[model samples]
Target: MSTRRKPQMHSSERARLDPFIVATGDASPRDQQDLMERPFFSLAKAKRVTPILYKAGYVQVEVYAVPEHGLATIWDADVLIWAASQIVEAENEGLRTSRFLRFTPYQMLSAIGRQTGSRDYKLLKGALTRLQATVIHTTIRNGENWRRHQFSWINEWEECVTRDGRVEGMEFVLPDWFYRGVIDRSLVLAIDRSYFKLTGGIERWLYRVARKHAGRQPSGWTFDIPHLHAKSGSQARVSDFALDIRRIAARQPLPGYRLDIEREGRRELLRIRPVKLSTESVGGTVGTLGTSGAGGIGTSGAAPSGLRAQDTQLTLWPETLIPGLNLESNLDSNFDVGPEDGGKPAPDGAASRSDTGRSEPVSPDDTRTREAQP
Candidate 1:
């Protein structure tokens, strides 16, 4: 009898169809870190931000949110950080990493130093939803010709459930743009775990700016206060924005960076310097990771007293006070605004241009401002 025999599948073929999965055990090693150089997430609170278009020079960024759903905040970047860390770790271990990542809620929350409570789990889900829903239109990686590309932070995601209706795990696909950036070794940088402890949004944004610009260079970087305001994409008035910078400088909270305030002919400049590893080990206080020096300059020995409490405050005069300074000229002169020429290596050694352009600092006549809500 010609019985229809079921075709046997090869083991390799079976594995290709259903690969074995690993659980995040306590002993699981943490992954290397990665951060996006360009400003992607909004620093303002989701509740306060409106669907707005931010433009500086030739670069333009548009952020949109649904009616009930608010825009993604800087805190949402935590998810990206976790994803980047995992991908980099996998690449380093010679394991294949993909857009589709399977992970438990606990694994993600714990890795980012977030609490593993039920509320935190719900919050995580909400963050994921916002990330998926928030749409961004930008000319970042697009060439100088003004082409626009649009994408969400995440492409798609879904959760797995057990027969008992308990959530088992989740899987999400990252956007190709973000994935490509993470996989490229040059685009990634290691940040201190203490970054999570930062309490202010401006503080968090400033740290990213410092990391992207100063990198590991001993000389660090300098940004004019007015220019920095223009680059922050903040809706705050220039005076208030500058005040926030002063307050953050007074606290000296950012990890791996030292803040110094300088004055040049009435122009106030914020200088960010990389703290030496040795100095970090000796003086870092927030977490075991490293040091805290609000006023003292790093190895550069510029001036220890420059950023002291007294010196941290900026003095504004009406004539030099160019509120909402013109960004077109500043963008071209002070920063690298053009896309990577494709052949030349990026200054920071990254394969791609580290930043498209600095965010235009917002200027308003009113000095009064509201503190950003958490």
Candidate 2:
């Protein structure tokens, strides 16, 4: 009877694992939680090195930024991965990160800095080289879903031909876990182009500021520029400049704080509202500059006295996108009208052009008017 005994029965039967469940489980615990609700990069592991996924279209990448343990904001990548992890993870859950994540190098470059044939370019190349060395190869599809993955570092000054001028740029992705950890509370301040040019590279300067302010509670910082100017007049009176400074400061994440501006013999003070404004709030400030008595803000000191709210104009920085950082896309898609013959066939004995001038052929309206008179 023992030899002929049937297989023993079990109290519970094993169930087939749900692929969906397994898929969700694959992501790191820290990555599953909503990042917006809780700042990523606040965790202990994040405090050590972390990864960030930044994609600009078909181009997906993962980059690592090491937080100096509550000391400084230096995100030097130790590893770079192009797993398209977010997309892979999203597919498992029947979703995807926003389409904005797709590769759009032209757009990506517009955010970091303009393309210049200078040292800044060298720094960008160096950064790219460092990134290439760290990237690892991996795929995340299901059974029978094999796909090869690879990423080529963009060569410097390669033309990214958008409808607008071929802009220059680069981008790397950050891992989800890394996203939730270090860059959690990172506040993106859209530096107005005018402001950056005034200071010569505002984003770079702000990165330095953020690095300096890293790990500390947001409190106060001072701007001690030699050529600080206010919209009021050439003198750059503190009172005239105070409102704009305070307006700019108020948009920052810091709250319940007062900002005091001082230059030479002028000082003006303003307070940050308890509620922080989104980056768009800064855009509205441009409207204020045009309509408010701050009219002179953009007039280059010619129209200083025209201070009326109706005259407010939004003096936005040349739109810059910071991927996860900037809320505004800051994309410029205006069409430039070239000469009728495709740019004034060189000014070789041609008319003195006005502006980036290209002379257009005589208008049909003139011919029509001449015939109508007969």
Question: Which candidate number would show the highest TM-score if scored against the true structure?
Answer: 1
Deviation from native of the Cα of residue 59 in model 1, angstroms: 3.2
> 1-374, model 2: which lDDT tens digit per residue?
01112111122110111001111122210111111111111112113244434321122234343232221111111011111233334444544232122233322222222333333344334444433333322221111232323332211112222244332322233332332222221211111222211211122123223222211223333333322221011223455444545445544422222334444354332211112322221222211111101111111111111011211121111122111322121111112222222222322222211111212222121111111100
TM-scores, in order shown?
Answer: 0.66, 0.23
Compose the digit string of candidate 1's lDDT tens values, residues 1-374. 12222223233122122111223422221111223333455666535346656564445678787655567767777677667766666566665455555566656666655555655666777778878888888755455454777888877666655555444556576665566656656556666555655655678778877766665656676678877775666678999998899888887878888888878798888887778532232233221110111111112111111111211121111223212333443222223223232222333332311232222222221111212211
For each candidate in the order shown, give its overall lDDT on alpha carbons: 0.53, 0.24
Model 1 score (lDDT) = 0.53
Candidate 2 overall lDDT versus native: 0.24
Lowest summed lDDT window (length 10), candidate 1: 288-297
- Alpha-carbon runs more than 4 Å astray in model 1: 1-37, 143-146, 162-165, 277-374
On a 0 to 1 TM-score scale, where does candidate 2 land against the true structure? 0.23
